[model samples]
Target chain A: MRPVRISQIYLGLLLALLLYLLPWGGFGLLVRPDFILLVLLYWLIRSPHLCNIGTAWMMGMLVDLAEGGLFGQHAIAYIVAAFLAVVYQRRVTLFNRWQQAGYVFGLLLIAQTVLLILKLFSGGELPGLAYYLSSISGILLWQLVIYSKIKVTGDKELG
Target chain B: MAQPQQPTAFFVRGPSPFARLIFFFALSIVLMAVDARLHYLTEVRQGFATMLYPLEVVASSPIRLYRYVTGYFSGQTTLMRENGQLHLQLTRESVELQQLITTQNENAHLRSLLEVRQKLHYPTKLAEITHIGRDPFVHKVDVNIGSQQGVMAGQAVVDGAGVIGQVTRVYPFSSEITMITDKSLAIPIQVERNGLRAIAFGHGRDETLYVPYLPANVDIRAGDKLITSGIDGTYPENLAIANVKHIDRDPDSPFARIVCTPAAGTDRYRQVLIITAPPAVPQIETEPPATIRKPSRHAPRQD
Candidate 1:
C-alpha cells in the first residue's frame, strides 16, 4: 500500500555492504553474519519491485570482488537465494513471525550450501561444522532486526 | 517506482524468477571460468579492489580507534618494562651486529679474492597490517603498502623475528600477503644445523606447515630450524622460517609427515617488512656459459 523510495533500497544495500566490509579476524571471522544477504532478503520481501534477482547478482559481484575469491561464486549463491526469496515473497508476508524467521533462516542455509558446494568443486578443503556458524549468527541478526523494527512501521513490511 | 500493472497481482508483477536465476547462474559460471582459467581479469580485479579500499578503511576504522584507545590507556609500568627489555635487546643485538659486520667484510674480501659475485642486499620497507583476510579459508592479510609504494607481488614479507609470508596481490595503495600457513604457498627451506634442503608447504586448514614426501629416515628432527635456501628468487637465503614441531614417521607410510610452527609471530604482529629483492634469475640467464659442463646446474656457488 505504501511506496518504498528507490533510493532507500540502494542505501540499505550500501549500509549492508559497509557492515560486510568490517575487519573481522580469528574467531570473530568464524561467526560473522552475511550482512548483505540479510539486507537483500529484507528488501526482497518488503519491496520486490526494486530489489529483485538482478540486485542480488550485482551485490554478489561486489562481494566477490571484495572477497578476492572466484569472481562469480557469490553471484551464483546470492541469485539462488534471491530466487527462493522472490518466489515466496507473497506467502512470506502472510506468515507468522516464527515462520518468517524459519523461512529466512532456510534461505541463509541454502545460500551457504551453494557457496560450500562451489568451494568444494574448486578444490577447497572441507571445512568443519564451524563453517555453518555464520548462518546461525545471520539468523540471530535477522531476528534482532525483526525485534528492533517490529513495533514501528516495519511490522507490515517485515512479514 | 511504478504501480503494479495488475492491481490484483500480489507478486506476479515481475519477470519469472526461474528465468532470472538461470540467466544469472549461467553468467556467473562463465565469469568464474574466465577468472579461474585466465589472467585477463587480474587488472579488473585490482581496479575493483582499489575502488573498494575506501569502504575497507571505513569498516576497519573502529578497530583502529579501539586499538589506539587501548594503547593510550596502557599502563605505564608495562610500558616501562617493555622499554627496558627493548633496551637490553638492542644492546645484545648491537654486539652481534658488530661481529656480523666484521665477518661480512672478511667474507667480501674472500669473495673478491675468489672473483665470486657479491651477495645482493635487498631493500625492505615497513608496512602495517590493516586487516585480516575476509575469507576465513584463506590465510592472508592486507598490508598498508602497495604498488604505488614500490611493493610488488612475489616479494617476501618478514617480521623482526622471521619470515611470515609473501606478497601475493598488489593493489593501488595496499597489498595482500598470503601467509606461509596458506595451502597455496610453498617455500624452499634447509635445516639450519645440517643444511638438508627440503620444501615446506602450508597446511590449509590450520596455522602450520608440513614437509611432505621426505623419506622415513630423514635427518630432520624435532626443534630443527628451517631457513630459506634461496633456491627460489622470491626469497633471500638464510631467513628463519619454521621449526620442526613434530615428525610422524608411520611404519605403514614411507614418507615422514613433518609439521612445523612458523618462527615469526604471523598472527601476533601487525607490522612487517617487505623485501623488494631484484629478480636474480634473469641476470644469470643473460650471461654466456662460463663452462660447458653442468651448465644447467650452475648456481651462484659451486656445490
Candidate 2:
C-alpha cells in the first residue's frame, strides 16, 4: 500500500458527508448508523495527524444542523469519542484487525450512549435497547470494509 | 523499506488531548445552550443546509435511479392488471362523485337561499418527495417544491389518501415537511361520529398519533375516524387524519390512551399535496381575553 494522501482523506470525508445527507425514514431512520462519525473515526484511527477531535467536532455540528436537533449534542459526543481515539491512537496501530474492530465498536457505542443520555436529559422518551442496534450495524460495516481489503491506514506501516 | 520521517510524529505538538477535549466540550456546551435556548441559530443553520443541498441531491441520486430502473423493468402483465383494476375503480368512483357533486350544488343553493356563508374552496399544489429526512432521529423531509413554488410554513401537507403532515420550513427550491409522527406536531381533530373535538399528538415511539387527556368515559369507539376540525385554521375541515386503532383503558392510567394510525402514511408517500392557504396568524390585542370575563367552557370554535 502507498502513503495516504490528504486528498484521499478529503474525498472520503466528502463521500461520508453525502451519505449523511441522504433522505432516511421509517425503520431505516431509526436504525440508521452514524455515517459521518464512522468515517471520522476511521480517519482519526488511521491517521491521527490528518484528522483530529476538532474535525470530528465540526462534522458533528453539521449533523446537528441536518438533524434539526439541539446543537452540540452530537458535537460533544463526537469530540469525546475522538478524544478517546486520539489517546489510544498509537495502541490502535499495534492492534490487529479484530482488536481494532473491537476498539471501534467501543468508540461507536460510547458516542451513541452519550447521545442517548443527552436526549433523555432533554425530556425525550427512553428509546429502548433497539436504539443501540445502529452501533452494531456500524461496526459490522467497518468490519466488512476491513475484510474487503480496503485498509483504513495504508498497509505500509503494518508491513 | 523507507524510514518514516522523525517530525511526522508530531501529534503532541498541539494542545494536549485533555486540554483540547475540555476546550471542545466547553464550546459544544455553549453552542448547545445557544441553539436550544436562544433560538438564534435557525437562519445560520438554514444557510449552511442550503449549501449542503447539492450533496444531498447527489447522495439520493442512486436511490432514484434504482427506483426508476425497477419501475421500468416491472412485469408488463402486472402493469396491465393494475391499469385494468384502476379503470374499473375509477368508473365506479366517478358515478358516486357525480352524485355527490349534484348534492353539493343543491346544498350550496339551499345555503345561499338561507343567507348562510359559502364554503371556501381550498387550493393545493403538488410536491414530490425529494428524500426522506437524512437524520433517522428527526421526522422531517425535503419536498421538491419550496418557497419559489409558493410553499409556506404551517401549510398542511396531504396525500391522495389523507393528511400526512405540515410544511414547517421552506427553502428556495425545497421545503421541509415535519411528519405527523414528529413529536412537535399536533392536529386538532373531531371524532367523525360524535363531533367531539380533541387534539392528537404524535407518539414518538412509532408512526402513530395519540389523543390524550380524554376522560375514560369519552364517547369514542374503536374504528372511529378522526377528521380535521378546522379550529386552528391551518388544516381545512373534514380531512381524514387518522382512524382509531386501539383504545386502552388501563386502570393504572388516568387518561384514556387512544392510539390511531395516521390515514396517510406518515412518511411513506412519494407524492403529497401542499394546501396553499397560509395559516391565519393570530394577532395580539391590547388586553388579554380573561379580563373581559368570557365563559371558558363554552368558548366558540371559530373559522
Candidate 3:
C-alpha cells in the first residue's frame, strides 16, 4: 500500500549482487538462481518508474562483467525480458497470484533462452538441459519472496 | 460537490518501452561485437574486476573461515599419522637425492667436455586457489596471488603431481588461471615413450584434452604419458601433463581421436606453484649459410 522508495530498490539490488558474487561451486553453482535478474524483475513490475529497461540493461551488464562473458550477452537478454515485462505490466497487475507467478516464470525463461542463443552464436557449445536449472530455481525464489509478504505487484492479493 | 483536478501531461516518461528496448539492444549488440571480435573492452573489464575484488573477498570469506576452523580443530592423531608418512617419504627421497647429486656432478663434467649449455632452474611462487570459475563452460580458477605478488599472465602453473594450468589474467591481488581442460588452452606435449610430439587441445564440453591432427596410424596408445615438449617456451620441459585415456582410430578420418586425463589434480588440488621466471629465450643466429646449404642439398636428394 505504501509507495516504493528509491533507496530500498537500490539496497535490494546491491544485496542481490552480493548473493550473485558468492563463491558458488559444483552443484551449488549449477542450481544458483540469477538473483540479480529476479530482484530486477521484482522492481520492474512493482515500480516501473524507478526501474525501467535501462536499469535492467545496466544490471545485466554488471552480471556480464562479473561472469566474464561476452560484454553484452546478458545485457541484451535482460533488455528483451524487461521489455516484455513492461509491455504487459498493466495486465500482470490484474492477474491472480498463480497467474502472476506463471507470467514471471515465462519472463525468466525468455531471458535464459536469449542468453542461450547468444552463447551458441558466439561459438559456445550447447550445454545440457541442466542449464535451465537456474531459471527454475529463480522462479522458486520469486514464489518464496512473494509468499513472505513482499509485494511485487500493485494489488496485495496478486502479489 | 468536489471539483476534478486536471491531470499533468507534461511530465511524461522520456520514451516508450519499445523505444528504450531497441536502443539498449543496439548498444548491447555493438558492445558484444567490439568485445568478442575487436577486444576493445579489455581495460573496461579489468577495471570492473578490480572494483569487484572486495565483494569477491567478502563472498569467499565464509569458505576460508570454514577451512581455517576445520584445520585448527583437526585431531592430533591425524597430524601424527601425516607426520609419520611425510618423514618416511622424506627418508626415501633423501636416498634418491644423494644419488642424484652424484649423477648431477658427473653430468656437469660431461657437459663441460661436450661444450653444452647449462641447465636452467626456474623460480616458482606458491599460490592458493581462491575459487573455481563462475561460468561452468570455462575451466578456470582464481588464485590468491596476483600482479602485486609479481605474478604475470602466461606463467605456467603446476602442482606437485604435474602441470595444471597457466595464468591467463592478472588483477592487482588475484589472478585467473585457465586449466588445461579449458577449450581455449593448448599445450605442446611429447609422448614420453617414443618422443612423438603433438599439440593437445582442450575439449569444450568435457574435462578432457584432444590430440588432434595426429594420423590414425600414429604410434600413441592408451596409457602413454604426455610431458611438456618445451618447444612452445611457455611450459618448462618434461613436466607431466596427461596420460592417454582413450584412443579412437577412425578408418575414414585422417586423424586419430586421442583423449587424455590430466596428470595433475584438475578438480582436486587447492595449492599450486606458479613458475615466475620464464625460460631463457634462445638467441637466433643471423648467419647460418653452411646450415642453409646443407638443408638445400639434402632437399633434392629426398625428392
Best by DockQ: 1
List where candidate 1 sits over 4 angstroms from the true fold. Answer: A150-159, B1-11, B282-303
Candidate 3 off by > 4 Å: A154-159, B1-12, B279-303
In order of TM-score, best first, we have: 1, 3, 2
True contacts kept of 2: 0.72
Q: What is the lDDT of residue A91 in candidate 2?
A: 81
If scored against the real structure, what TM-score would every candidate get?
0.91, 0.89, 0.90
Clashing residue pairs for model 3: none
- Considering only chain B, what TM-score does candidate 2 achieve? 0.87
True contacts kept of each: 0.78, 0.72, 0.69
Give the 10-residue window scoring lowest on summed lDDT in candidate 3 chain B: B1-10
Error of 1 at B179 (Å): 0.8
Candidate number that wins on DockQ, 1 or 3: 1
DockQ of predicted model 2: 0.56
Which tens-of-lDDT digit does each residue in A101-122 have in candidate 1?
Answer: 8999999999999999999998
Candidate 2, lDDT over the whole model: 0.83
For model 1, report the TM-score of its A chain. Answer: 0.92
Clashing pairs in 2: none
